[model samples]
Target: MNEDITRQLREAAEAHRPDRAQMLARVERGMAGPAVRHRARPFARSGTRVALAGLAAAGVLATGGLAVAAIVAAPSPSPSATVTTPATPSPAVSSPRPTSPRPTPVAPAPATTLGSSRPTPPTTSPSPSAGESQNGPLWSAGSLDSRSTIYWTQSNLALKTTQPLTSLTIEIRIVQTGAVKNTGTWQTLPSDDFTVTVQEADGALVYRWVLKPGRTVPAAGFEFAAQFNNGTAVRSAAGDGYRVDAQGSGGSASVRGGFVPTR
Candidate 1:
């Protein structure tokens, strides 16, 4: 019952605007005789609600000269006017003195970003977990590093092939989430065994690793990782992807896929 009354009161208060015309009408209605109020006991709750709302509204409306209206509506005797004269104000005291207003509050700074200490809830939709996707002969998997700070992040890519490759090129594209820039890259394979180039094109940091002449990707697993700056907030890698084009004794085979999204 208390909750019901509170809900009704809020609804009534919101419906009642603190305005002049309604104030006078309410005042006249509220001035009913005691006998009339006694006969209206059935509507007691509603009456009390309006009366309380009207009192609160009066307090707010009084700031807009409702007090003067009250004086005019119910005039007092001439002696009451004389009584107010003695409460006179001096020019210096009442000439719109410079009152010091409360200083406007400043909002606190935004969240200072850093790597998540624990597993943090992602901001984007849940995606396939890392080590989920397999593309062609090149069994590929990807995951964002746990040490990724807000301003910079790293995505690790793992590649595996069942067949030894005579020629291979690995292309990893880091989707342009925000302020993305490649800091550096590394791989499990010998650095001299591959020609690596990192460049920005088509709104992404494109990292390409070509098996150097005569140097081949083995049948075993290999790791090719790249690190880049993501920006000041957790990022999503929905569009980020990779492609592997390789030629073995069997024939040329290719596979392409995107990195799972992350926050």
Candidate 2:
């Protein structure tokens, strides 16, 4: 009977335990009351794997960019590298020679009425001739008046009979009709072809001619003059009238003429 009573007391204590919901509420209260704190767990190993993979990708990109930049920065070589070249500075590009300025053309001189270097025969005066003067030959056709005149005469003396007369008188008589422009004189050559003197009338020398070598005697009115070589000149009438000693070969055929001033 005592053992049955102990068993019944233990049954009564078990039947009186708190309901399950109420027990759960008490456990929640204890948890929320700040009696404990929860901790986060360490990251998964797979996440560490992902992070390592991303680092590897960034390293690859950086390495590729560096390699490309190095290649681009490299220098290139010139084509003539192998040749030993002269150091001569590139020939200064000589500025193309400035073209010589074209020369200005000159105008030709005009035609003139003035006489040529060659001598010309004196024009005869219109006045009547005075008979041969006491000085020499008789005046037959030309006048010794102020107007310039040229008088010529043939010698009757034979070349043998006549001593060579190279000298002759050249008179210039300024008559009432004579003009002052007639101021010069000349003695004729023995050849009867030319007349020359230092002055036409005390003028600068002018060689006057009636004939030239290798040329024909001019027409009756034609006349011209040229200078002979210095020694070639025969003595002239420059003194005491123009005079010359004639060469002996030709005699009577030797002719004489005088150039006289009229002014």
Go through the candidates in order and give each one's C-alpha lDDT.
0.68, 0.32
Measured by lDDT, the strongest candidate is 1
TM-scores for every predicted model? 0.48, 0.24
Candidate 2 lDDT over residue span 196-256, tens digit each: 3433344323333233343332112211222222122232222211112222223212223
| Range of the 10 consecutive residues with the lowest summed lDDT in candidate 2 | 152-161
How many steric clashes between backbone atoms does each model show? 0, 26
RMSD of candidate 1 to the true fold?
37.3
- Residue 228 CA displacement from its true place in model 1, Å: 0.7
Model 1, range 135-185, lDDT digits (tens) per residue? 556677666655466686656676778888989998889877657877777
Q: What TM-score should be assigned to candidate 1?
A: 0.48
Q: Kindly report which residue pairs in candidate 1 clash with one another.
A: none
Error of 2 at 243 (Å): 17
